[model samples]
Target: MSRTRIVVVGDVLLDRDVEGTVDRVTPDAPAPVLDVTGVHASPGGAGLAALLAAGDGADVTLVAPIANDPDGRLLTEQVEVAAQVVPLGHAGRTRTKMRVRSGGHTLVRLDDGGPGTPTTVPGDVVAELVDAADVVLVSDYGGGVTRDAELRARLTPVAGRVVWDPHPRGAPPVPGVRLATPNVAEARAALEAHGRHADGCGGPAGPERVAARLRSAWGCAALAVTAGAAGAYLADGGQVRFAPTPGRADGDPCGAGDRFAVSAALALARGAGAAEAVEQAVVDATGWVRAGGTAALHHRPGPGTPRPPGRAGESLEALAARLRARGGRLVATGGCFDLLHAGHVAMLQTARTLGGSLVVLLNSDASVRALKGPDRPVQHAADRARVLRALGCVDEVVVFDGPDPAAALARLRPDVWVKGGDYDTSALPERFVVEGHGGSVVLLPYVPGQSTTAILARSATGPRPDLEVLR
Candidate 1:
């Protein structure tokens, strides 16, 4: 699929995760002097919404404020993953939140920085990007990103297709937008501003009532109310559909709501039905945020190699079933990986990045020996499996005890087939097999010095390390 660019506008902030373990009480004034374990940073506010879009295969441009200060530097650094960032100078401080955690529970959170009103963004850039965007998402976090009337006026014209998480106090959008994604609270406010009957978070006119009213009030084609664990209320042409979130919605709800918004936008951009669209989004939201508070689109290099996008993966058949059911796509590749090196990681990452789940055709002990001769595959199959599983680019692992993974690929026909740069697509013996099932083949990057061959060469001249002893 070609790139689907999305423009996300509004508040952009930084999230500092201060994680630690608390063993004993603090010697300080009534505070737990917890032993800090580590810290991680993530993009918050609209930056997070942009992150979700980027993670879901959308070329996202974050059009938010960068105050041109130290905190602005942090916001800019945090949102470096986007395709383009529109910095709004003059807003002195970039909003930041530091959350203190203990035993996976957030004990306290201290917020730094404050909202700043954006004055301008490089010429008519906002309008141009909005016009070019396949989907536009408004993350009105009330962080002063969308406060300008002129900016809103310019942006409203190109709202042919937009998924808005509207700020409660922002001005009304331009007419003719396709969809508005709001929680129950913001829905009431937006709708009530147009003289409709609704209340924030859900009151007299709940989601169903507000969705119906907003469609006419703002000329929105559809409306979706993200009800958190109660799922979501989707309405189009006066018809309402309530899609419930998964059972695991009770998990860490840190940023899952933002994930749901972006995922829903992506699904709609892909032309999915409302319920189907929300289902995919909810899945992505709960899976990522519930697990690690990470946005869906991960950009980390594959095992420090030039791997594909979705390299780190899980079950193949299971993933395939989910994707097939929802029309999601996937890619697959195989390798011996007796020695995990950059080349192998790079190859797997690229394979997954092409799109969807990357099923690794693993070489069992016997298969590696058959292919690479004796004294190879020092690591046991189970140990190799664990190593391969650790890489984020690989989704599923299938161990073939004999040899040749074509039989395995035939069983699970992925949408795309990828191999390392060492071989041409023509030389892929199963290329036809994949094509027979309507799958395409591509060659991935080959990182030098990251090969088993290199390791073998180095070992020949010195004391060989028994890296496979763990297996």
Candidate 2:
């Protein structure tokens, strides 16, 4: 399947986190002295939204204004690897938000640069990108990107779904936007700005009323008002639905809006309805928060690492604990994968689309020999694992030594267990194990004529060269 093309156009900024430890009181003042330990930098605003979309396996393009400064250069370098970044040069310094933290708690936040006008991308360039998009996300961070009339006009006629994450200082979206996501504070502020009597929180006019009013005001097809801890209230047409969050999320709420917007946009790009998209976004955002929110961003390893961000080979118990803390869907599939083929790729990619992460359980050499006879497993377990790690669809790979994956399933406790359509639930020995953990088993479509057995058979009929496979 072709990847979904997403275009994110809005404000971009740089975020820096300075972490340290408070050791003693300062001699100059009575404040505690912080011994600096580490510093981390990442993209914020539309840049982050694009990164999130790209992380979800979408073809993303970010169009935003960046100043010609140190912070701007850093933001550009960081975001360019994640997506196709198109920079519109601005005159002022790029916005930078610095947070000082100690022992996982923020001491103070300092803001530098900002409240400045963002440079507008050329009209033709904006139109060209938006025209080819599967979904357009407008991340208005109270910056001047959305204030450009020409850009807004170009987005008005987009054939794809348009999702607007509104900011009070930013301009409203064009008419006919598909969805609008705003938190309770932003919703109340917007309503009050429009001369409407809106109670910010727990007011006589609840979130349902606030959502309805915002939907009409923005001329959007649907509106979702997010109330932290209380979930979100979605309003479409005359009907309103409340989708409560799974549990209370603990962590910084800074990037929650960006995560929510990108997830919803990706869902829409995949052809999900408005309500379903909003619900999925809520789930993703909730998981993001529970995983330490912005704190998780700093845990990534530096360059030249052997394994990718989520591809490390860990014990089943360790992996399960990490996934639970992360609070997203965990998908697992087991197979020999003796000779990685298109069918295997398709199954893995399909499994990834079913959840936030995909874990592949490979049959160890001993197990494959037991299952497929002595002449099976064209490739060794190590070689097979190396190849699987190269695929973008696979998040992690584990080799299990058993005829059935019941033991692995019991330890991992994955949320979903996937298999090819060729097999039925009753035929799978691990089906009961998965269901016992409150997980579902999914049978994905199988690609015919794309099996390793057929390839090996054809090879045997042809000239048999040295088949000294690596052990």
Candidate 3:
């Protein structure tokens, strides 16, 4: 399928996360001393929204101002990976946010640079991009890029779906936008700013009232108020729908709204209705948060180190603690994985897409012997782990010394427990354990004629086997 073309216009900035460890208190001051471990950086604001849309398989174009500075150069390099960036001229330094974190907790955040008056891009250039786009997203982060009345006017008559992510410090969107997404706080503030009294906007009738007020005030076709863990409340054409988030993955919600905006815009470009687009956006945003949210920009601790990033073999307690701290979604599946066939590869790949990280709980040599009988398990536990680690879809490989992964699940408390399609949820023994921790069980489709037992039987009977049959 051809990708949806999305044009994003708004503010762009650079975000940096400095991760370190905190030990003893400083002798000179009362503050704790931090020993820096690693630093990571990514594009933020509208740049993030554009990158997110591009990541979701859209052809995204970002038009925003970047100061001629080191930060601007860095931002350009990062954003260009996922979008075609059109930089506008500005006189001030590029906006940058630096966060200092220790042991998965943010200690302090320092903001550098300030918003400057953005030089207006030519109207013809702006109009040409908008004209060709399937969706147009305005990510106003209280920056002046969207403040130009002429630029806003140029976008007003575009024939594509328009999604507006508003910031209080920035100008309001022009009329005729298809959708407006704002968090609860931003929604309340926006209503008051427009002289609209949303007296019952925060009550049971909150979504309905707020949506009505905002849709009318901004002349938008629909409005969705993101209520964090409560999900998003959407109102369109006088009908209100509540799209509950799949589950909560706690992390810094800095770019969550931006993710929501781009997801919804892409959905609209794909011909989904406003309510359906909002629903999909909620699901995408939930996944984004589970995958470490803004923390993904920083270094994560791996195995065999005090702080290592990505998935490496570690104790269940340690992995669970780190995932919980980062609000990550852990997707776990277990099996003997004796031969590592095509079926196994496909299952692991599908499981990884369901959440942030995929943990492969491999059976120990003894456990595999018990399950597969004495003659099974052509590869050892360490060899199996090594092969699983080689696959990009597999994140962490943990060898469990039991027939079932109940003990490991108890320790890890994964958000999703995955299995093959051959197994039914009702027949699974660990269903209760997974659900008890507010997690769900997923069964992926199993490939036919791709079992180790079948392969072994064929190998024993024939001199050689066809590679196509194995696949």
Candidate 4:
């Protein structure tokens, strides 16, 4: 499977998070003195979007103006970790946004480095990148990148392949772009800029109306107006649609928009419909926020630090990305595992030896009931998962509601798909999916005479059952 090519074109900035506690006030003034603890830095604006796209396994190229300054060097160092940088001629100092935070809440934000826009646009280079990209994401951050005439000229011809994330102070999207994503506030402002009243609340259909008007005014094929935790409203093909967030997410929404835009761009690259892309974007954005947003980026496990056991609500995508960054092979196997016996234990232990980590895709209780009879699966899905995760060989346990593990396999995209030797690898439905992603299917020998059904039958008879049978 070749990687999807993504080009992120827009402004790049430095983001600095100063975490501390505000415990004392100065005697001379009422200003609070922060006892600084740590300062974390990363790329902001389109650089962040590029890094996110790369984190999702996309072949990302960042085309942005970066100034030659200390902050610019810092931003470049972070962005280069995940993306290839194509620097445009930049003027002024590197833009930096510093937030003073304490106890998960931000006290103040200081913005510096005014207007780091491109002074010289590389027209041919920009055109070549746009021509080669599967999806071109214009992550306008109200910087002067989007206003560059040469860059706009190159992007205008490839509008159909572009997903524009518009800003309040940025130029409008190129005419006939595939999609334009703007927050509700930006949408309202855009409507007013185009001579419409921005204050009118059109009942429950207000977002829909706003999205439609923006799409028409922007001359884009589709438009989606994001409303933070409330989700997004999309207008496509002369119809209005709403895609609500999967659930109520309560966390910092610092990079939610970047998450939304990048996911939508990737979905489009994967041949999804406009509505499907919007829905997926909303879900991804909500999940990102729920997982602590940008703060979660710095939570990598250090050297000799053991990985915590996988639990419910953990981000499987994030775990996979981290493992992939280490250049390690990922192994996966799925089963009902109704009873954790020697057979299950042996198969899992062997699978772990084939790769750096093993992810067990446990079937949900409902799925087990469908596969087995109604009286089957003595243990529920949660208990089964808990037991599987307790094994030293298992790195993560994911419970799938489907009758088969096809959907789960698609998401994990493991390098090795393992199963019991009782079944033929050629006859496994999962074999096709595994091979489609350049992975191989392996079959480990099943432990003979050690079956869950047999154990259950023996348990119903009496307490005189041999303990050696479980071994």
Candidate 5:
């Protein structure tokens, strides 16, 4: 199969991170002293988007202004490891952002260097690169590259294949661009820049309104307003769709926007529609955050790295203890997964994201009969556990005997208790047990018009030949 060629255009920056630990306070001042442990440097801005695309196994080329300074050289070398660089020439010093962190938390960030405006744009070379690219992602970082007349001219012609990840100080997306991804705050600011009031964009439909207005204003074919952990809202012509995140992930989200833009560009290049691309991007971005965001890139688990229990033969208690020891939250959700349809899969997938690992408290055959009636549990407990464990999102499945999973939940003691929104949390017997132990309960939206009971009824009346009769 031919590789997807992705070209990233915009400004680049050098990112430096200083990791250390804080202990005793200085004698002269009240400030705590940090004994530095390590220092890491990498590319930021558009260069980050290029690296992300390249990491996804795409053929990536980054087109940006690069200075000959020390920081610029460092940024280019790191970026070049993952992508080819087409320097547009820089008029000023290379920009840099340095963050000091201790105990996985940032103490402070120091930004230095220059405005980093592009001095030269070889039109022919840029045109050639754009023409050859399957997708062009403009990752604007409020720098002068996106505003350059020569760069804009080259981008306008291929706007149909362009995905613009916008910045407040950067140029707006060229007309007819495929997609523009802006975080909710940036979207509001963009509207305000156009003499439109952002106050009108609020409530449950806030993101949808922002996306539609931005798409029309920027002249892009579609716009997706990302809301971080809440996922994104896409506006494609007259249609609007909200792609909610599966669940909350606890990790650094520094380069998640870059991750999102790269995923969307790759999806569109693979022939996915704008809405479909945004949906896939949301999932990809969430996973990036779950894996410790951009910081995880520096400290990836090697071949010999010990992994948490997702493999077979791991006990539920062992998995829970390991996750807790690593400061990872344990999420638990219970259900009588008799049929295991699309709805069940969706719910399970969402629950898994609520924490580091997911433990499914599956109802026993006897439990299902008591709660769902004698005709329930078409599949036996063993078969149900096998299917649940087979799901990539599910960590472990524990069969518990009872009408409710209250007794089992007391033993599991997950950090988060998840359930479908169809049920009332106040009425759930397991709620007290979960909250009493300092665990929180979350109710996720259920897929509309999908239920095991309904499926069984349909099966009894006129079962599809493709389906097996469990009874």
Candidate 6:
């Protein structure tokens, strides 16, 4: 499938995260001494949202100005790494947020904001980019970027899908925008600005109220209010629907809402209706949050699911504790991975769906040769390992020394163990190994006719393989 082109424009910022461990109070000032382990510079604000969209295989074009400062240099270096991360102008200093993490929570954050108005380079850049995109995503970080009237006017003539994530600055809406995603606080502010704040609770209180006011005042076609834990609500040209959050044993929720926004736009662009779009986005994003911020983990169900923690689960207690410390899930999936194709993608995403961690177990080159033939698994275990780990969804990969993933899962004992297609759930390989240690297994819905064997036969060397044979 051709990637959907995504053009993200808004306040782009750099997030510098410093991770450390605190031992005890220091004699110097009665403050704790932190032994810093490492520091990472990741994109934040609109830049992060756009980076994630690109990671999901979207053709992304980012148009935003970076300030000509040292922090801007940090953002520039990170952006340059993303080959597709287009920087519009470096005329002004880039917005940078410095967050310090100790133990498990963010202890302190220092933010240095740029002048909240666009410079000459950014203003001219947006006008040029808007003309070339297939869909326009106005990610207003509420920084000074979209404050220009000229930039707002340029967005109106956009001939493609227009999605706006209203910056929390209570800015008035421009005309002809199709969808606006606002959080609870921004929703409340927008309503008050329009003189439409009605007091209520739980039932049509915050976001719904704002949507009603905006749809009437500006003639906006659709609205979605993203509530952190309660999920999001959508109102289109006619009906209104609430997309409920999946009930996962909760974990740290970071960068999850942005995942929802990116998925929502992508799903809608792929022909999913509004309600389906919201639900799918919520499910996927919620799954990511529960996996400890990486978006590849899954956990046991929430407070009210009627079932037990099911079959071959991933994390055992020992491993789960370790993953929590590292801030990701322990994911394990097993397959030939020989001549990798669509079936593999589905399985990898499914394993991720189970929790916040991923570890792929590949059949060793020797093992593949045994299972297929002397000429099979043409790639060595090391080469295969690199290929799988390079996938955006995969975190770490190890080649199974034995024939299958049983030995690998036995040692790693990840929070979840996943298998592809329709193997009998009753005889699932990793069930007893994980469940005996109190972990549960989940059976992801399998996609038929997408096996490796099917793909090879369809290549130019042969006739159209009737995959119906697998059925």
lDDT of 1 by residue, 220-257 (tens): 77777777666677788858988764443222467766
Please provide TM-scores, in order, for all candidate models, with all chains considered together. Answer: 0.61, 0.66, 0.67, 0.67, 0.69, 0.64
Against the true structure, whose lDDT is highest?
4
Q: Report lDDT (CA) for all predictions.
A: 0.70, 0.80, 0.79, 0.84, 0.83, 0.65
Clashes of each: 23, 0, 4, 0, 0, 29
**RMSD of candidate 6 to the true fold?**
12.7
Poorest 10 consecutive residues by lDDT, candidate 1:
303-312
lDDT of 5 by residue, 33-103 (tens): 99999998778899888877877779999999999988888888878777799988887788888989876
The lDDT, on a scale of 0 to 1, for candidate 4 is: 0.84
Off by over 4 Å in 3: 201-205, 298-321, 324-471
Regions of candidate 6 where Cα sits further than 4 Å from its true position: 26-31, 83-92, 121-125, 201-206, 294-323, 326-411, 414-471
The better candidate by TM-score, 1 or 5, is 5
lDDT of 3 by residue, 1-471 (tens): 788999999888788888888879889999988899888887889888877777667888998888888889988887886689888776589888888988777899998786645775777888899999999999998878668876788888972378999888887778878898888878888888999877863553475578777878988888898888668988787777899865444545667788789889989989999988998888767655545566664433432112112112235765565655544688899999898888988989999988877788899999989998998688999788868866877666778998899888988889999998677688788888999999999999878878888778888887444566776
> Considering TM-score, which of the candidate structures 1 and 2 is the better prediction for this target?
2
Root-mean-square deviation per candidate: 17.1, 14.7, 13.3, 13.7, 10.4, 12.7
Q: What TM-score does prediction 6 earn?
A: 0.64
lDDT at 206 for candidate 3?
Answer: 77
What's model 6's lDDT at 189?
A: 73
Cα RMSD for predicted model 4: 13.7
Query: What global local distance difference test value does model 2 have?
Result: 0.80
Which is the winner by TM-score between candidate 2 and candidate 3?
Answer: 3
Two-way lDDT contest, 2 vs 3, winner: 2
Instruction: Give one digit per residue, the lDDT tens place, for model 6 in 1-471.
Output: 777887787777777777789888789797777789877666677776676676666777777777777777666565454425555554446677887777556777898766535565454566667676656777777675566666777887772367777776726556666667777777777776778754567555666656566656655667787777778878777666787665432545666766677777777777777678777777666655645552222132442221111111234443355455666556677767876677688778778866777767788888898888787775787667656755667755556665666656777777777776667867866788877666667666556777666666677466555765775
